[model samples]
Target chain A: MRGLGTRTVLYQQNVAASLGLYNNDLKSVDILRETGPITAGELSKITGLATGSVTALIDRLEKVGYVRRANDPNDRRRVILVPEYEYKEEVGNTYRPLHQSMHELASSYTDEDLDLITQFIGKASAILEEQIKQLNVKKSKSSS
Target chain B: MRGLGTRTVLYQQNVAASLGLYNNDLKSVDILRETGPITAGELSKITGLATGSVTALIDRLEKVGYVRRANDPNDRRRVILVPEYEYKEEVGNTYRPLHQSMHELASSYTDEDLDLITQFIGKASAILEEQIKQLNVKKSKSSS
Candidate 1:
C-alpha cells in the first residue's frame, strides 16, 4: 500500500517535471480538467490554496494556454476559469503506456478477482476521502 | 483508479498542511526516513531537485524540528541528513485511524482475496514505476 502511494506521487512529480510545471500546478490543471469551468474562488476552496496562491496558479496555467478565464454568463462580477480540454492530449499521451499496462493487468484477472479487488479499492478510496474531509474540517476550524 | 490517485494526493496535502510543511517537504521527510541517513546530494539526486532548492527544503524541515543535518564521520566533507523519527508520532497519530480502518478492511477479506488484491496492486505499482522511469529518462535527455 505504501509503495503504491509513493509511486503514485513519484509518477506525478515526473510528469510535472516533464511539462515544466510545479506538482501543484499540474494538479490544478487536472482538477480543472475534471471539474470543467469553475470560479477561481471555488478552485481555491477545493485546493485549499489561499486567494493569492490560487490566483497565481491560474496565472501560470493561463500563461501556458492550459486554462482560460472568462466572465460568468449569469454573473458579471464572477470569472469562470476554463480548462482547455485539448491540453489533455499531451498529458494523456504520457500516461497511455501505464493505462495500457493497467488495462492488460486487469484483463488477466478473473471476474471474482476483479470484484474483490474493486471492493477493496472502493472501500479504501472511501476511507481516504473520509480522512481527507476530517482533516479539512479540522484545518478550517483551527484557522477560523 | 483516478479517484484513488487524486485522493492519495489530497491525503498527503492535508497532512502537509496540518504539519505546517509543504507537501514536497513532508514527502522528503518520508524518503529520508525510509532511506536513513543520506547526503544532501543524494537527496537532490533522488528527488530531482536542484541543489539550492534542496538546501532550502532542508532548511525549512530543520527549522521545524523534523530533520537534522550531521557530518559523515568517515567523510568529513559530506553532510548527512537524519530524520527525527520521533516526529512520526504526530504524523503517525493522524494516520493511525486510517491505518486501523484499512487493517480491518483487509481482515474482512479471505486470504485468497487478499492475495489477489496484493498481486494486482503490486503489478499496478510496477507499471506506474516503469512509466515514471521512462518519464525521468525522457526529461533528463531533453534537459541535457
Candidate 2:
C-alpha cells in the first residue's frame, strides 16, 4: 500500500528531473503534450496560469531548447507554441529507463490488479482535485 | 492512453499545489508519505539529495508547521522527522475526490484493458528512465 504512494512520487520526480524541469514546467509540457501546437494565450487559458507567467515559462523552455514559438500564419497577434521535435525525442529517450522499470513492475501484477490500480489512481486524482476546490470555496466564503 | 498521462499530470499538479510546495519541497513529504518517519540521514540517502539540502528542507518544513523533528533517545545525533497529524487529514481529505473518481473509472474498464494500459505506462516510464540514465552516463564519460 505504501509502495503505491512511493511509486507514484518516484514516477513523477523521475520524469521531471530527467527532463531537467520543475513540476510547473511539466504542467506546461502537459498542456502541449496533450494538444499539439497551441498558442500562448490558449495555453494560459488551459493551465489557468497568467500570461506573464506563461511567457516566462515559454522563454525558459525555449532557452533550454525544449519548445519554441512561431508566428501564427492567420493571426499576427498570436504566437503558436511547437515543441521542438528533437527535444521531444531527447525527453523521450531519457524516459526509457523508467519506462522499462514500470513495465517490469506491471508484469508482476495481474491484469485485474493493474486495472484496479489504474482506476484507483484515476479516481483518487479526481477526488483530490474536488476536495481542493471545495477547500478553496470554503476559504473564500470564510474570508468574505 | 493519452488520458492516463493527463490524469497522472493532474494528480501531480494537484498534489504540489495543495501542499503549496514545488518539486524539491515535496521530496520530504514524499519520503514521509512512503516510509513514514525516517532519520534525516536516511532520507538524504534515499532521495539522493545532499545532507545539507535535506537539513535545509527539514528546517523549512519545521518552520511551516508541516513536519517535526525528534531526537532519537538511543542515538542523540540522529533526528527523526514526522509529518504532523494535520497533514494526514489534509492529504486524505484532498485525495477523496480522486479516489472516488478512480473507483468509478475502474468499473468502466474491462480488467484486460486496464491491464494493458497499466502495462503500457509502466513500460513507458521504465524505458524513459533508462534512456535518461544512459544519456547521463554518456555525458559524464564525454566530459571526462
Candidate 3:
C-alpha cells in the first residue's frame, strides 16, 4: 500500500511538472473542475489552505488561462471561481494517454470482477480518510 | 484513480506535518527504508531531485536521527545512507493503525481475489511509470 501511495504521488508530481504547473495549481484547478464555480473560502476549506493561499492559487491559474474569478451572482460582495473550458480541454489532452490505457485495462475485467474491485477500493478509501482525520487531529494537537 | 492518488498524497503530507518533518525528509527516509543503503546520487535519480537538493535532504534527515550518512564499504570516496532502525520503528508506530486496518481488509478477500487485485495494481503501476518517463522527457524538452 505504501509503495502504491508513493507511486501515486510521484505520478501526480510528474503530471504537474510536465504541464509546467505547480502541484497546488493543478490541485486547485482539479477541485474547480470537479465542483464547478465555488467561493474562495470553500476552496480553502476543501484544500486545507489559507484563504490568502487560495487567492494566490487562483491568481496563478487565472494567469495561465485555466481559471477565472467572477463576482457571485447573488451577492455583489462575493467572488467565485470558474474553470475555463478551453484551457482545461487542452490540459485534458495531456492526460488522454493515461486515461486510454486505464480504460483498456478496465475493459478486460468482467462487470462482476469490477464490482468487487470497486467495493474494495471504496472500503480502502474510507479507511484512509478516517486515518487522515485522525492524523489531522494529531497535527493540530502537536502544533498547539 | 485521481481521488485515491490525492488521498495518498494527503496522507503522506499529514504524516509529515504530524511528525514535524518536511515532505522531502519523509521521502528520503522512505527511500532509504525501501532500497537499504544507497548513494545520494541514486536517491536524486529515483526522486527526480537535483543532487544538491538530495544532499540537503539527507542532511535534514540525518539531523532528525531518521537517517545517517556512512562510507560505502566498496569505495573510499562514496557515501551511502542508512535508515536508523530505532527512529524508523518509532515512526512506524504511527502507521501501525493503518497497516492493521489494511491487513484486516485484505483478510476478507479470497486468495484468488487478492491475486487479481495484485495483478491489476502491478500492471497499473507499470503504466503510470511509463507515462512518468514520457512526461519527464516532455518536461525537459520544454524547459530546455
Candidate 4:
C-alpha cells in the first residue's frame, strides 16, 4: 500500500515535469478541476500554499492558459479560479493510458467486489485527508 | 480511485512540508528505503532527476543526516547512498498514524479480499510507473 502511494507521487511528479509545471502547481490544478471556481484564498487553503505563493501559482497557470482568474460576481473585490476546459482535455489525454489500463483491471472484478473496494478506498482517502489537514495545521503553527 | 490518488498526493505533500523536505526529496528517500544502498547515478535514474540535481539532493539529504554518502566498495570513486536507519525510523514514525489506521481498516477484510485488493493495487501501480517512464522519456527527448 505504501508502495502504491510512492508510485502515485512519482507518477504525479513526472506528469508535472512533462507539462513544465511544479508538482504542487499540477496538484492545485487537479483540485481546481474538481472544485470548479474558487477564490485564491480557498485554493491556498486547499493546497497548503501561502496566499502570496498562490498568487504566483495562479499567474504562472494563467500565463500558460491552463487556468483563468475572474472576478467573483457577488463579491467584485474577490477573484476566483477556473480550470480551462481545453487545458483539462489536454492534460486528461496524458492520463488516458493509465485510466484505460485501470478500467480493464476493474472489469475483471465482480460488481460486488468493486463496491467493496470502492468503500475501502473511499474510507482510506478520508483518513488520508484528515491526516493532511492535521499536518497543515501543524505546519502553519510552526511557521508562525 | 482518482480521488484516492489525489488525497494521497496531498497527504504526501503535507508530510513533506511537516518534515521541511521537498515532496520529491521525501519521495527519493522512500525509493532509497526500498532500493537500499544505490549509487548516486542509480538514484538519479530511478527518481528521474538530473545528475546535477541528484548531487544537490544528496548534499541536502547528507547535510540533514538522513542519508550518508560513501565511496562504493567496488568503485572507490563512485558515491552511493545509504539511508541511515535512524533517519528511516524518524521519518517512518511520521507515517505511523496513517499506517495504524490503515491496518485497522484492513483488519475488517478477509484474507482473500485483501489479496484481491493487493493484486489490484500492485497492477495499478505498475501501469502508473509505465506511464511515468514514458512521460520522462518524452521530457528528455524534447529537452534534448
The candidate that achieves the highest lDDT relative to the unseen native structure: 4
Runs in model 2 deviating more than 4 A are: A1-6, A74-76, A85-89, A102-144, B1-6, B85-90, B103-144
The most accurate candidate by DockQ is 4
lDDT per residue (tens digit) for residues B1-144 in model 1: 766777677788888888788887988887887789999998877676778989999999998888999998889998899999556678888778778988999999889778889989998888887887788778778879
In model 2, the Cα lDDT at residue A135 comes to 48
The lDDT for every candidate, in the order shown, is 0.83, 0.64, 0.78, 0.85
Rank ordering of all candidates by TM-score, starting from the highest: 4, 3, 1, 2
Candidate 4 ranges beyond 4 A from true positions: A73-77, A85-89, B74-78, B85-89
| Candidate 1 lDDT score at position B136 | 70
lDDT digits (tens) for residues B73-109 of candidate 4:
9999887899874446557778888989899999999
Interface RMSD of each: 1.5, 5.7, 1.7, 1.0
Q: What is the TM-score of each candidate against the true structure?
A: 0.86, 0.69, 0.87, 0.93
By descending lDDT, how would the candidates be arranged? 4, 1, 3, 2
| Each model's Cα RMSD | 2.8, 5.2, 2.6, 1.9
Candidate 4 — what's its lDDT?
Answer: 0.85
Clashing pairs in 3: none
Q: List model 2 lDDT by residue over B45-140, tens digit each.
A: 555455898889889888877789998777888788987734566666665666666667666878876666565555554454454445545545
Q: What share of the true interface contacts does each candidate keep?
A: 0.69, 0.24, 0.51, 0.85
Off by over 4 Å in 3: A72-78
Number of the predicted model whose TM-score against the real structure is largest: 4
Q: What is the DockQ (computed on Cα atoms) for candidate 2?
A: 0.28
Per-residue lDDT of A40 in model 2: 86
A29-64, model 4: which lDDT tens digit per residue?
Answer: 888888889999999888787899999999999998
